[model samples]
Target: MTVTRFAPSPTGYLHVGNLRSALFNWLIARKAGGTFILRLDDTDPERSKEEYVDGIREDLEWLGLTWDREERQSARLDRYADAADQLREMGRFYEAWETPTELDLKRKKLLNMGRPPVYDRAALALSDDEKAALRRNRGTGVWRFKLDQERIEWTDGILGDVSIDAASVSDPVLIRQDGQVLYTLASVVDDTDMGVTDVVRGADHVTNTATQVQMIRALGGHVPDFAHHSLLTGPTGEALSKRLGTLALRDLRARGIEPMAILSLMARIGSADPVELRGSHDELIEGFDISRFGSAPTKFDVEDLVPITASVVHGLDALDVDEALSRAGVPDRLRKPYWSVVRGNTATRAEAGAWWPVFSGHATPEIAEEDREFVVKAFEMLGDPPYADDAWSDWTNAVKAETGRKGRGLFMPLRLAVTGQARGPEMADVMPLLQKKPSFD
Candidate 1:
């Protein structure tokens, strides 16, 4: 059976960039009736907080990206240790004792000689005595995986055939001096041990994927199919990394962006398909095609979510917005009619709150100077609250006949005077929801 995993470090909130990877993995797994694992890369205990882990779960729940199971690297420390030991016994793992300054100097010297800044494996030349002396002097050095100096190639699920020269790439550090298991080793161990069959992430990990392919083979594990989706950018193609802090999923939810709106756009953004508002997870799953996605940086505009959210809101039934309507203080009796009245005009369910005040007559009226006399006369004919079904038509007809006003000139002012807006639900539908009659006095 097919299996996939989304491993995120529980160090911060999930932004749109993170959402893309999660959504892709989820959709892929769901489409194939496969298992999707939510793995927490919390090896850095100092930075990873339980609150962030909770936030990750909450965000995924909000997006309907339910995982079949969850795994944390913190809980699997012994497994990583075993894997590291196995690589060391195979002569593929070695201790590196270079400080950051020393490594930087070596890289500079290599570049000055027009050579790739790959690690020169200076640690491999050290005798056991020298190694013991260095360990005593500098404490414990980082563990680096030895790459078989050859062309590492794979048929990427999205980027087509990919090839990287292992000779040009430095050996990856699997364990830090602080004894923390880095992502490369932990992910490789987890992916293999947990039976993950596919991996999808951002394009930035392409090189990592290449190195990981070698590491997987060296460890005697099946290398999962890997796809690197393009990174997201601003609307005009500016780098999205700097702006991710503001694009947290919770912030978007607070702004009343619908989950389906976010899901629909993300599933198809860089793909060949045009983004269409999906009403449920089934729709998104049925239409997802990872092969259809392009590798170019996807241009994401937060503004794009507005119209899609409005579309989602417009299709909602009364029960669909029951919570939002109730929070807006729309009584049970008014829920259906109130939604019917404002659903067409709203871009979000929260907008129902704005309309409730208008319907209840607590909103300030917006009458224009030229139409003040006309609006005052119109309201005089409106009488008191608990109006009849035809009350708006009757009152408007009386005002139209008395003033010879018609069309937009007649209806626009009346709407503005009553609801404090030039555009909203039709006056006919809005009339019955009024708790207090309009007063332009």
Candidate 2:
């Protein structure tokens, strides 16, 4: 069966780039009827933390992407060690006894000669006895992969055929002198051992693939297909990073962004395809295709996400909005009023007033007259009676019976009187709250 994996290094909060990578992987796995794995690459002991790993899992789940299997790279040290041993036995790797200072001098000397300062493979030509002596004498050194100086080429699903000569690439350290496996070695071993069939990750990992492909070939492991989707860039064209103040998923949710909004934003960013702004999770899954991903970097714009969210929010039934607000920790006192404004503004549903304006009007008393009137109308329609459980139907019926005037004109005056505003939350949301004793009616 086809299999794909999202391996995130648990060193920080789940950033937008990481989320995008996971989304693409999920899209491919779901589209192809393959297994999706979430692997925690927490190998950097000094930087990785349990909290970060937990946060990533929570973030992915929040985005509606679930993995079929999970694994941790740190827990599979023995597997990486075995791979390194096999490569060493097959003469595909050699222990470099050069100290940092020695390597620096070699690089500097090569640079002084106006040549690219790559690791000199001639340094690995020690005799068998000499290699054994150095191994016994040197207490600690890194193991470097011995790359065959030949051109390597592979077809990427997104980038088409990519080729790079081995001479231009460095013989990267597979295992540090401290015995901890490096990221490349551990990632390749884990992906192969877990039977991953497709690798979908950010474009930042595009250059790293060459070294990994060499490792896989040397170890006699199957090389999975790769698709390095473009990275999410900031407006200035720089890659998205924490230093750039990119928004986190939790932060967006806290700010009242609906999950579907976030998903829609994910679909649109760096995507060339025209996807409907509103759809169920299953609908999105069905429409997702790898070819839809754009090659150009996507700018992470919060403004672009607002309309998408509003579509999702407006399309939901009343109960769905209630549930979403409840999960967001919206207060009971503000729930009815907030939903009132949201439902009323659904027709306009402009990006500028979707969440904050609606939330502020409910939580604060600073709403405009027009907006407040809508709020009152909504509350009234939701069976929130005027003056202590007095329903609008009864009030309209009584007023019409006594004055011979219809219900339409009475709605505007009643709405204006209660909320002191003209165009805010609907009467449906306002009436229920106004039904409380000492009501404004």
Candidate 3:
């Protein structure tokens, strides 16, 4: 069975980009009857927080991306240590003693010679005593994985037929000088030990996947099939990385973007499929096909979500929003009809509150300067008491005959004067719910 995991660092809340990565892995697992693991790459304990861990869980739960198992890198320090020792024993891990300034100078020297600024691996030349002497001077050396100088290739699920020259890439540091096991080493150990069989992540991690693929084999673990999905951009194709902080799932939730709307759009935004609002998580999983996605950065527009949200709201059962209508002062007799009337006018459930006051208690009329006379005539025609379902049509038609008005000029003033807006649920439906008759006064 295919197994996948979404490994996120608990340093911050999740954004839409993060959602795409998480959902891709989740859909693969769900579609294959496999396990979905939530691995927290919280190796840097200094920056990771419990609140962020909670936030990550909250965001995933909000999106319905439930995980079967959760693994934290902080809890697996000994596992990483053992892997590091095994690599050192196999001559695949080596100590490197180079300060940032020294490495920068080496890079500049290599660039001056019209060469690639890859690591020269000078520390590999040092003998044991020389290394001890250097370590004694610099406290401790960082651990770097010694990559085989060859081409690394894998058939990526999305990008397909990927190859990288290891010699051109600098050896990744696996363990920092301060004894912190970096992501490069910790991820390999966890993914291998946890039986992660399929890896789906952002395009930015394609090079990282090549390095991890080698590490996994070095540790005698099966190499999982990998896919690198394209990154996201703004609606106009501007880089979205700078603005993702503001687009956190929590922020979007606060902005009233429904979870299903977000899930539906994310499941298809970069794919060949068009973005269609789905009714449930099962629908998203049933239709998910990673092969349909492309490597081009997909353009995402937050405003486009408005209509999808309206669509979601339009398909809800009266029971789904029964309590909300109760809280908003809709009478038991009026809740069903009230929801039917307002759902189309609303892009989100929050907008339902705006429609309540138009009928339940009070509404301020919005008559334009030129149409005030027409509105006054219409208001007087709407006499108090014994109003029916056809009261708006009856009053408007009578006013239309009396004032020689028709079309928008015939209807807009009446709509604005009564509901305080030019558009809403059919005024016929809005009229019966009105506890008080509207007037120009």
lDDT of each: 0.92, 0.72, 0.88
Top lDDT prediction, candidate number: 1
Ten contiguous residues with the weakest lDDT in model 1: 376-385
lDDT of 2 by residue, 1-441 (tens): 888888888887776667777877887888888899998988889999999888888888887899998999989998888998899899888877888898899899999999888889654887878777777888667889988888888888778888988888779898888887888999889878888888877778876898899888888789999888887777787756744344877777666677777777776667677546747677778777776776777777766666767666666554556655666555666665555555645532223233432233332233346545544544454442233334556666665565455655656655555554567666555444442322332
Model 3: what TM-score?
0.96
What TM-score should be assigned to candidate 1? 0.96
Candidate 3 lDDT score at position 78: 93
C-alpha RMSD (angstroms) for model 2? 6.7
Question: 124-174 in candidate 1: lDDT tens per residue?
Answer: 999999999999999999999999999989988889999999999999999
Better of 2 and 3 by lDDT: 3
